[model samples]
Target: MVEHSNRKDSRAAEAHQSSCLDPFGTWKMSNAAHGFGYPSFVSYNGLEMVWAILFYVPRWLWKNWEAGKVSALRMDLNLGIISEVEKKLKKKLLIDYMYSNLKHHNFWAYRYFFCEFLSLINVGGQMVLLDRFFDGTFFTYGIEVMSFADRDQEDRIDPMIYVFPRMTKCTFHKFGTSGNIEKHDALCILPLNIVNEKIYIFIWFWLLIIGFLTFLVLVYRAAIIFSPYIRALVLRMRYRRVKRECIDMVIGKSYVGDWFLIYLMGQNIDSVIFKDVIHELAKKLGYRSRDIGET
Candidate 1:
């Protein structure tokens, strides 16, 4: 009996080990079985495109220009034979030279710095999304509205309480006659075995604070960058004071003017200009109109 019991216990231990090793029910399963996959491909690709366009292209052009200048200077300063030797050395040690010049290359340094900045933003956004996904999967509960009850048992009914799955917690709200809600109340039904809620609260608080600060920084940066364009738009709107139709015509003519008109439209500036620029344009084009407004 002792030998049989030992064999059974050993088998149970082996089974437990197997279960732990193959948590996804199959040994061939991938890491994606545990929810690892592409977080946000669209966002990642868009950021990469923007980075390539705004940072990479300019950096590449600047580097090429600098390389050309260096080559030209070397050609201009050196005699033909020595310059040929330098060219062969440059060809052989191109990588080494590039690395050595990296310290002095402002554009190259700025490109890497901008890439690091973008990486930080991308990682932060992905982390936030991942946290949200986890929170939604595990911590969130769905509510189903059932029958409402009058708690007061009087003509003036008390707020209806919405009890969660665990009956200890509920949310209540009373409707007033004036189509308004009043006397909102939420009751937390604490479990007999209490979990430390403070940590969760702290995490959410920290995320909120960090996210808000990041938002403010981005807004400030955007405002600074676009201030010149904004100023130009405001000036144009103030000075031009043409109808929306005329603005449209101007936009059709000039891309910069189009952006300014878009800004003006977003600002909801008064379009009630007495003078119609389109009408003037039409007249210039030898078209007759009875009313500028009709034109």
Candidate 2:
């Protein structure tokens, strides 16, 4: 009789425990469903649209901006230092970084070096190299881009222990075999997203405008192929430099050629309209023209 009573009480306790955990299990299931594209990460169609825009619009804008801003022009600030050893070391490290970023497929590290550290090496020739070697030897954990680099100049200047920003960040690890063999991973971290994002948006907008104008030209050409005068005018306008140079040479012997051309253009029917258009453009662009003779 006592055994039967104890068994009944044990079963009741087990039921009570399950009841207590029931709400938690339900919450966990709900969270999993939400993560799996069920109304949790996104509440409605509008939220889904936001994600779509983030994926496509931002990517398209970034591509256009990068194309417009892309240049092979490398920026190297030569400090004119007399240390050949330092120069060799710098070059080797830079090459190593490039190789690692490209060869080993470590994109994050590569971008960090090129975008952040490269821009910050503007000190008075007193250079510093922070690599995988310095990781465990000097600091506790590795430094992250957001953690080390910030919008404020104070945070940026902290890494180098100097006023200017000139130090690279990397990772190093130790492997054990017989005693210990060390493995070092070099990393580059650049905190350029905030500034780069703004610049990218501006360039992308301008590129989009340029793209539309080009499309317009193509459409106009396809429709108006038979208009000889219009076609000739369009071609001339497309490559107006030769005509502009001839006009300038004829009337700009004693004056600045561009200003002389401007004066000549000011005296024409189309030129007057163009000047007004340009003035409106300047107003829209929020820039005032400097007076002549002011540099």
Q: Name the top lDDT candidate.
A: 1
TM-score of each: 0.22, 0.19
Question: Which digits, one per residue and each the tens of the lDDT, describe model 1 over residues 21-72?
Answer: 1232211111223332211223334544653464354356446544543443
State the local distance difference test value for candidate 2.
0.31
The local distance difference test score of each candidate is 0.36, 0.31
The clash count for each model shown is: 0, 1
Model 1: weakest 10-residue lDDT segment is 157-166
> What is the TM-score of candidate 1?
0.22
Scored against the true structure, residue 220 in model 1 reaches a CA lDDT of: 45
Q: Tell me how far the alpha carbon of residue 172 in candidate 1 is from the true structure, in angstroms, after superposition.
A: 42
Predicted candidate 1, C-alpha RMSD = 24.8
Please give the distance, in angstroms, between residue 126's alpha carbon in candidate 1 and its true position after superposition.
Answer: 5.3
Q: Model 1 segments beyond 4 Å from truth? A: 1-196, 228-295
